[model samples]
Target chain A: MARAQELAMRDYVQEVSALTMRWVHRLRREKFSMLFTLVQPMLFWLIFFGSLFQRAANSEVMQAPNYMSFLAAGVVVMTVLNNGLSGGVDLLFDKENGFLERLLATPIHRSSVIISRFIFVMTITSLQILVILTVAYFFGVHPATGLLGIAVVLLIGMLFGIGLTALSMAMAFTVKSHGDFFSVLGFLSLPLIFLSSALVPLSAMPTWMSMLARFNPMTWTIDAVRPLILSGWSQALPRIGMVVMLLLVFDALCLYGSTRAFRRAIG
Target chain B: MGRTVAIETLKLAKAFGDVKAIEHLSFQVWEGEIFGLLGPNGAGKSTTLRILLTLLRPTAGHATVFGHDVVQEPDRVRRLIGYVPQERAIDRFLTGREHLLLLGSLYHLPKDETLRRIREILKLVDLEDRADHLAKTYSGGMKRKLDLACGLLPNPKVLFLDEPTLGLDVQSRLRIWDYIRRLKERGITVVMTTNYLDEADHLCDRLAIIDGGRIMALGSPAELKAGLGGDVVSLTVGAADMDRVESLAKSLKAVPSIRAISTKPSGIDIRVESPEKALPAILDAANQQACRLEFIEYHRPRLEDVFIAQTGHAIREEFPSGE
Candidate 1:
């Protein structure tokens, strides 16, 4: 019995790795998919911040040493979140195009397919964040917390991103249309991004809005990444612990929903 | 399970809401034989194939591929059989070579074997020349050939092809058929579905004709044709003169050996116990009616005649726009 269980575990790992290779192929094959993960978030950061707050670089209200630096951490973490959510759009496309049915017919573990998508989105989004941070570093964005801070930001960002990805995949299975998925995503994304500390200081916001931000996963993520991007790991340890705890809860909920949806789909 | 049958379904049935897609479908395919599921659109041929591949669960009963239950042991069945889905699931962004490699990995072929099979299967499907080009840039025939190559990559013991040449030109269709015959020569059991009567007749060693989610007939091409027990005589009358010809032919049907007469858009088609003995009377009637006879042809019964004899309608009529 023990031998059988060990064999099954090995099989699962093998299947997951095989699926990840295909996910990598899918990511590399489509030029637009890659650009959506990396460049889109940078563009959002440029247009929104450059327009709303022109003196962000010089204002003490920025609180951080450099305004762009403070905002860059938030943008980086947001990129990870959006990238994970947007990964499900590919699953939606697969269903519309009939590829999902084909994949389900194959002999791999069903959950391995979902796990591959998570790993693919996580790895690519992390790389994109690193690229943006490297560019910011060249432009005088200091790393007050250093490499440990950067790693903490990425770990929390990735976990939260995965939770969003699972939720999006659940939506893809339930809502067949790309337009419906986009509309629903739009409904949820903007409010979460704005209500959080992504754009400005939480102290400047009203009490009710601050309460919403505090309750938001994005808010915990920003608080975690901000200190890391500004002062390094020691300054962000307590916030990172809180973000990790919230991420675990969120990931559990999304994963449960996604697995249920997957079973329905295979039917 | 060892030699009695290579594939079998025990009273298999499935439904989608109120629509019964397949009803009590039970059949056995012998080892190393090309078994064809010949049917019109919505006749449950594709549905049966999907179930055998473990893509869908049976509502009742069960199926086995090489003695493994399709429902409970799908991974084992998958390891033994290669399935070419009805739709083109080939990733468009990847090259033909890349697609094969990815599928090979999924099938658990080792790295060296995967690379070797990719090269060999690419050549087998005549895709070697376009192996490096992105699949999105490939022609329809090329993409289909690549799809076939992926199915063949794992060197499966059995292969299932659903409408393998549904959208190909005549040349491409013949190419796929020729490769299929080669696969058969190598002793790979192939189960295929096609609406093309001629394809089923020419390619399948044994076939089942399905209509309205039921198997109306099943046999080899020769055996099925022989079951009709007569000859088919087709007369092409001018569109303007079909009415006179039909009336005359109907009047002659009472004569002995004149089995039946049917009117069609192109002309009048008749089935008789012996066309050689009955042709003179048909010609005589046409002459008496003063109807222009465009053409007359007589031949032994074929798969189409068998389908018509069983269903009382043309298989082509059942699939109005499938082609």
Candidate 2:
């Protein structure tokens, strides 16, 4: 029984860690792509939000005390969503090239595989978000909130990253091909980014679009994280709670779907 | 026999939809034996190996490596054996040393031990000089050698190679055969598959020929060939007067020791206990019938003849050469 347990530990720690390390190695080798994660959001923050905030550097139309400050928080959340969506493409490649089949042959803890992917994507996404936030601070988006708000920013970004990454991985399994996966990205991600108050105040959008934004996962992520970084850091629980609830639901669905896909692929 | 059977499969079976890949397949490889899973394409050779390695669940039945159940106790089985797939599974972006070190870690080798084993494996496969190069930049033979090195990193009790030299050039194939032989000499149990009869004949201590998800023949190379006859007298007859050639060869059936007469598209290939004794009678009968003989060749019976004896077609004809 002791030997059996030892073997099980090997499967969990060694096997799963190696699989995840591959993802880290892949990201490090293609370090150029991280530029897009940073530059893409920076471009939107400059053009769209820059024009809207030019008239009033500090006002209610910006929804916070400062417009650039409000928009910077939104930029960080969008960065997380982008990384999560692209990581799904990696899963599609595994399916197409039969690498997943090779991975299955080894005796490894199944959940470790997914959990490792979550950790890797979340790490890089948070780093890129930090870079964006630092740039915004240089441009005069000062935060009235304290250290607690900084922790909230990091926590919300990680939870959002894991949730969307799980959903994308689930898509990699259900979708017929890599092309199908990227097409879903094209159709779903951009609109979700735009619909949320990631670039503008929710009140600015028409009533119908505002209702959709309220339902959108991206909206919760931005709302939960923005207050912490901008000024209203005290009223944090409800928005953070909403983001947490949505993240848990998405994680459950994605983990369930990927496990099923794993079995099916092995068959 | 050194300790126990290194690998065993009992009534193992797998099916994909309506097509069976393996059916009630059973075999045993002793602790240090070089066992070959020889078969033509689609004969379920790789399927059987996959089952033994615990990669795919058997539709029915069970297999074990080093006395550990492959299905019920796969982690135990994985600890005892290494596997080299037909396609290279190494990360092309990683250096050869990195691939081996990572696999060694997965196998739970201590860090220092993992590095030591990586160096040793690279030396064994003669890949030490290319250890730092990315695997993608290596040629086919070099990549294959690195793959074998990865398999050996953990010092496994048994190794499974699925068509290790399938598409390799002649020199590379021979190099693989030599490495496999060296492994066997060190008392590592090996289970390998190949569609090439010569590969089995040259490298395997014992072989099993499978077809249509069943083992058609099994034995050592000499033993399988000896079962057919002492030699074969293969003759090519002109396309003209085919009936006359058949009738004339039939008339010589009175010859004392022609064990079997096999026919090929180009000629009648006959297996005889003694080629010299039967050749005169066969030739004289052809002369009497006025049938022209285009070619005649005689040699000791080969494993191809054994395959012919069992399956009514040469192995090459059954599994076509080239692709």
Candidate 3:
């Protein structure tokens, strides 16, 4: 029984990895789009948003030494949020074009496809976060916890991202067309971003809004990530643990929803 | 009598809200034969394929592929079959080779074995020369061939093709037909759906004509055509006095049966038996009715005649409009 279980687990891993490589190949082929999806938004935030807050760097309203440092974790988490929410577009295209049907017809474990998608989205988002952090480093903003803090930030982003990617995929399966998908994305993305601590810390928001932001996963992610960039391991680790627990619960719920959505769509 | 059944669906039915996509669709495909599900668009051919391939659950009844129940043991059924859908499923960004390799990997083919089979499949589909080109650069037929290559990558026991040649030109259609034949030669049981009567006649060893979510007729193409019996004499007449002309043609002695008479904007098609003996009488009747004859032809019974005989409607007339 143990041997059989081990073999099955090995097969599952192999299949998931193979499926993930398909997305990797596709990303490699559409190098321009991949680059644009990552670089363009980060650049917009860094230059446009960064310059707006530059004059208020050391102001009492700002919590960090500089606007760039204050905004770095926020931008990283925002990039992750953007990428994670839009990751399901690939699955939507596949479903629209009948590729999903072909994939589903194969004998491989069905969940591997979803797992591979999460891996793909997280991998791309991680790279984008790294690029943003590197640029911020050059601009005299550095993580207080240094390399270790950056790793923790990525972990927090990925944990938060898994649930978002899964939820996006569920929406992809639920909706009828790409138009409906984009409309929903357009309606939801800005609200989710603005309501969180992405552009501004939760403290800067109105009292009622701050209370709501406390319940937002993005807020939790940013709260956990911010101290690593501005303050150090002692300040970051406890929040990181809390956010990780929240993400675990979020991921479970989203995975359950998306799997049900997938089954319904295919059926 | 002991031939193995590759696939069997027993009283299978699927419904979407008020619409029944497939109703009581029961059929058996013997091992190593090319079977066709013949129907026009929206006739539930695709829905039936989806059920058999375990992509969709049937609302009632059961289907099995190689004795494994589709719903109960979908993974087992999936392992035994591959599906090439009507729409081109190839990623436009990937090369033909890359597509095959990806599919092979999904099938859990080993690295070396996958490479070997990719080469073999590329050759089998005659896509070796252009295998490295991105699929977006491929022509319609090339892309279809690539789709076929992906389906064949796993060496599945049964291959399901839904309208394998729906929109291809004549030459491309013939190429797909030949590839399907090769699949049969390799002893793969093929279940395909096509709206084209000639494609059904030329390729299917046995076929079931489905329309309005039910099987209207089922038999080998020759058997279905033979069921109609006798030849078909078609007379194209101007729209004037069509009802009178039809009644007159029905009165003729040589016309044992007025198989079908269809009215179009330009003309009316009248089918009768024994054209050689019936032509003069038909013409005489047309003249007496003051219906100007536009065209006339005689041909052996075809699958279209069988479809018409079974449903009292032309197969071509049922093609989904605006598609």
Candidate 4:
């Protein structure tokens, strides 16, 4: 029985890896799109846009050593958010192109598709996060809490992204077409970023905006990552624990919603 | 036929809210024979195929693939069957070989075995030369050939093809048909759904004509035509002369050996016991009425005739659209 169970587990793993490789192969084939993904988020935005706000956010009210250092944490978390929110687009395209229908007919665990989507989006997003940090490093941004803090920042980014990515997948299954999904992505991403402390300090923001940003998960993720980059562990550790707890609750809801959508679409 | 039963459905039914996609659907597909579900669009053919593939659950009744219940033992059923849906399911990003490799992994075949079968299937589909090219680079026919190669990856005991040749040019359709026949030769049970009368008549060993979520007629092509017990003599008349066309039909009803007559847009069809004796009287009637005959046609009864006789309408009612 144990051997049989192991075989079954191995089969499930094989199916998931195969499905995941399909997406990776797609990314590999679209060299221009991938190149665009890596270059667009780091070079233009970090150097140009970050410099625009560098001196403005260095005041005591902002409570940061410099704007470039502050925005590094935001950029890392934003990359994760960007990758996670649009992660559903590929699955939506697959649904439109009828590949999802075909996949369901094959002898595979249905969860494999969902799991593979999660792994693919997270891996790509994580790599993009690392790229954002490396590029920011050249710009004189470092994690004040050192190597361990860098790992924590990555962990927080991933934990924060899991729920949003799940929500994006749910949207993929819910929307009628890729056009509708893009609209949904646009509707959520920019608003969430603006409402968070990513671009401007919550202390410097207007009263109403700060009230709204208090509940935004992006703000939570950015705030947790910010200290690791500028203020180090004394200020970052407790925030990390609180952010992880809230994210767990958020991801559970998103996963439940996504599973329902997945079942509804395929069933 | 005293062959092994590969698939069976009893009182199967499915509904989407208030709309009934299929109901009271029952049939048996014998092993080693090509079976067909002949129906028009929305005739529940694809829905039935989906249920057998365990992609959808039936609202009522039971279906089994090689005695494995679709709902209760879906894993086993999936193991025994491979299904090609009515839509094109290829990814333009991947090459032909990549698609099969993915399928192999989904089926959990060993690495060396999958590699070996990929080579054999690529060759069988005549896609060995273009196996490395991206599917976006392949022609419509080549993509369809690759689709067929994917369905054959697991060497399934039963293959369900939903309108396998639904949207292909004549040569491509013919090539797909040839592949389907080859599968049957290898003792693989093929169950396809099509509205193309010629496809069903030419390829299927036995077929069930389904309409409005029900089977209207079920038999071999020859048997169904023979059951009509007559030859269908089609008399063509010009549309400009509608009055003469009705009078022609009215006069033909009095003739002996004529079983039935139905008037159509461009012509009238007469089901007679023998066209040999009925042609003289039909021509005599046309001549008496001075009905200018554009053409006259007679042949052994076709699946269309059987479909018309059973359903009281042409299967081509909606432009031969795919489900």
Order the candidates by DockQ, highest first — what do you get?
3, 4, 1, 2
lDDT of 1 by residue, A1-267 (tens): 999989777767766777788767766777685687467667568446734565645557767765677788778867876787777987888787766766666667778788888888888888888877887787677678777667766787788888989998999988968999999887888898889888876886888998888888888888888888777666778888888888899999998999899888777
lDDT of 2 by residue, B151-173 (tens): 78768889889899977998999
With candidate 3 superimposed using the best TM-score fit, by how many Å does residue A198's alpha carbon deviate from the native? 2.4
Which stretches of candidate 3 lie above 4 Å from their native place? B236-247, B253-296, B318-323
* Residue lDDT tens for model 3, B85-189: 889997888888888877877787788999999889989999999999999999999989988998898899999998998788889988999999999999999
As for candidate 3, its clashing pairs are none
Model 4 regions more than 4 Å off: B237-242, B265-267, B287-294, B318-323
How accurate locally is residue B288 in candidate 1, as Cα lDDT from 0 to 100?
78
Which candidate do you rate higher for lDDT, 1 or 2?
A: 1
lDDT per residue (tens digit) for residues B117-223 in model 4 = 99998888999999999999998889888888888998999999988887789999988989999999999999999989999988999999999999999989999
What is the iRMSD of the candidate numbered 4? 1.0
DockQ by candidate, in order: 0.54, 0.45, 0.78, 0.78
The best-first sequence of candidates by TM-score reads 4, 3, 1, 2
- Quantify all predictions' global Cα lDDT against the true fold: 0.82, 0.78, 0.86, 0.88
Q: Alpha-carbon error at A199 in model 1, in Å?
A: 0.9
RMSD of each: 3.2, 3.3, 3.0, 2.1
Docking class of 1: medium
Q: What share of the true interface contacts does candidate 1 keep?
A: 0.48
Give the TM-score of each candidate: 0.90, 0.90, 0.92, 0.96
Residue A151 of model 1 has an lDDT of 77
